[model samples]
Target: MTSTKDEISLAGRREWLGLAILALPALLASLELTVTHLALPSIAADLRPSGSELLWIVDIYAFLLAGSLVTMGALGDRIGRRRLLLGGAALYGVASVLAAYSVSPAMLIGTRALMGLAGSTLMPSVVALVASMFKDTRQRGVAIGIVVASVSGGTAIGPLVGGWLLDNFWWGSVFLAGVPVMAALLVAGPRLLPEYRAPGSKRLDPVSALLSMAAILPVVYGLKQIAADGFAWRWTGAIAVGLVLGAVFLRRQRRLADPMVDLALFASRVFSASAIALALAIFVLWGVNYAIAQFLQLAHGLDPLTAGLWTAPSAAGTIAGSLLAPRLAHRFPPGGVIAAGLVLAVAGFAVLTQVGPLGLLVTGSIVISAGLAPTMALATNLMIGAAPAERAGGAAAISATAPQLGGALGIALLGSLITAVYRDQFGHDAELTREALGSAAGADAFTTGFQVSAGVSAVLLLVTAAGAARFLPR
Candidate 1:
């Protein structure tokens, strides 16, 4: 039943070039995510933001981005993907410039929020466009791998790039760093990226858009709160309200003639399994990376730039794994490949439990990165591939949203666990060392927490590997 066109790759030199152009937004978005971590201290020093305002400055962008993705994805399907992408790129460029010049905490927060909304358009469009361009399965897998690598590469280099900028220039320069990238994307995007709009797609439903945002924003905000301040009734209540709203959103979708999100896509085991696997992979990766970054800076007493350099190997490992995944899939079944990678991740997490030496920590991280990269790439490929072409934008949005939610949950739950362990282990001196991890007791307690969290992560990955093998299609 398969057509010859499905088997043959239609992508030519131009398509390859277009793929590169599409990757820029994904790379920039991820870079923006981590770049601000280093810039926060500089921002605090210059802007003198209140504690609440600083949190908003840091959190608002991600909150808005996550909440907006599903609506934007559906919007791309109704409008043209390339059109949405180019428009978003222009907005992102303007917002970046505004962010750089902001004189007050409130101004910076508003600009960051705009950047987040602009960013929501990029990932789904990029993925859906790539899917449309690469008709052949193998080529599509390879192309998505490259895109995934770009994301990982951006996250890895963000702090290093931000550190170098901070060393030479003011804090605002970090925000400006994205301007040129967006400018280039704006200039090159229309020429290279092909337009894709689903035929007969209805007008976007404003009510559905509002419901999606209302459901997602509260949940994301709650998770971020849990990460920062541990569990409280206010945070848990927000999560519960979001869940109720989410159920209402789903019920509304089932009744709509043309749903914003196609409820049928989740019926496919391949789609659902791939999505869950992808989320789990990111959950562990982001959670552990959070702890590791602090470990390098607070425990080992390294500068941001130096610590970033040390983390480069892990990025290289991820790049290598992503590039190699499609080739491996050609030889073995995709599910098996994913399972094998997760097993390798288990070994990597095992190594982390014994991270007494700096080398061991770095090695474990690299191994973990290498192990998870394939899951990210191939699971994404499987998830997108499972969707009908008409629904590719929504599918890509779901793909984008899962990792964001997972990363948030991982940071909240795992970060909270680590803090709880540290406090418990610190015993009577916990209050004394609360502000900084300067004391020997504080350092030792953190290390213990790190080890315990790694051990827990290892078990979770092991179970996930089994699920991937059993549930994911061969």
Candidate 2:
């Protein structure tokens, strides 16, 4: 039988070492997400990809990663978490090497897809392993904080790292950077991490897994299309079809004796609330952060390296907030702490609305990162903690999935909004500005759109803050 939280001992040196191993994959997954954006121009120039092919090269990784997460998590639970993690790490390293050496866009896209599939296995397994290793409430909180910090920190620093790499070496160097990290994880994981498979877990269901992928891929693809090309009937239809399939998938889960996803877990208010809060927090962070990155470059006329350097402080703030969350939770209620953080994020968004000066933009981003990191860390802990040990992998997948969907939606919807507003500012040259923000006659139109987006983000965060205060457990 699994030990109750009360019966579990505090984590020791071995567990701490294991956590460091697990964090490598977590950090790598996030780094891969953001790092590739910087390399896109280089890839385009070298591979001579058409616009459509280039989009696929940039997006296919996330599409496969998000679509496959739930299935990979369940697979980890049925197999051994350690076994799955190490296997995935090996695959990731091989895929990264393949991606680096690819001569054609098709080859690069295929390798990136492989990397995404391998990435799907890493996060849920890492979170499940961390939960298993650090069973004590307080210790678990800190461990989760560290894991969350790694992800957020990696995202914040991705541009800086990618810029430096692109400056010194070929674009392929970015993909190669992950190879060593995965190698380290593969070497140490078997020795440091414990093996865990859910005891008496049911056989894996192929149909459910298919349904999950079918439901997720279309929706995510549709969102990405909207973000890139603006709204279209085809994309809306894709989302509608995915929603229908998702409903069907849920119905099947309700009837199955050994369902892939445990519906009962969502019955807990804690699980449901944490999931919602985490999603909303990511929604604002990613949507606003995306705009801010563009603002630093297109509006302010800074080069990639300079812009990355300007954004570095936000990365530091994210790490600080993530690490500080557990310590703060000891003194205040978790719900209160979360609400407070959201309020602070709203303030940051408010600052962003002014849309003047580089220092102001940097300050706003730093404040926003500082505020949202705590909410992400604490909510992740609550979501994963609410699950039974055997279901931790699935729980972790769900936790991870929500943020992916949220970030995608934020980028799509907010990006569309920004483009629309910017186009509105230019009557005769709308097409020109819509095609390239930097090529616009002036930065004033883009600035206006950014300000509007920030205001909308602030209002959404304020509402989320109120909900967190009222609903989440103290």
Question: lDDT of all the models against the reference?
Answer: 0.82, 0.80
**lDDT (tens digit, per residue) of candidate 2 on 21-121:** 88888788667766676576567668877655765775577667767887887888888889988999999999999999999989999999999889888
Q: Which segments of candidate 1 are over 4 A away from where they belong?
A: 1-9, 48-56, 223-231, 419-442
Q: Which residue pairs in candidate 2 have backbone atoms (N, alpha carbon, C) closer than 3 angstroms, thus clashing?
A: none
Clashes of each: 0, 0
Model 1 lDDT tens row, 1-474: 767765465688999999999888878866886677556656766887764576577667766777788788889888899999999988998999999999999999999999989988888888888888998888989999999899888877887897788778888888988888888888998898889987788999999899988997788667656644556999999999999999999999999888887889999999999989998998898778767766766567666677667766788888899999999999999999999999999999999999979999989998999999989899988988899876776787788877766765565567656667776665534353343332233677778888998999999999989999998877
Score residue 466 of candidate 2 by CA lDDT: 90
TM-score between model 2 and native: 0.91
Candidate 2's displacement at residue 393, Å, is 3.6
TM-score of each: 0.90, 0.91
Worst window of 10 by summed lDDT in candidate 1: 432-441
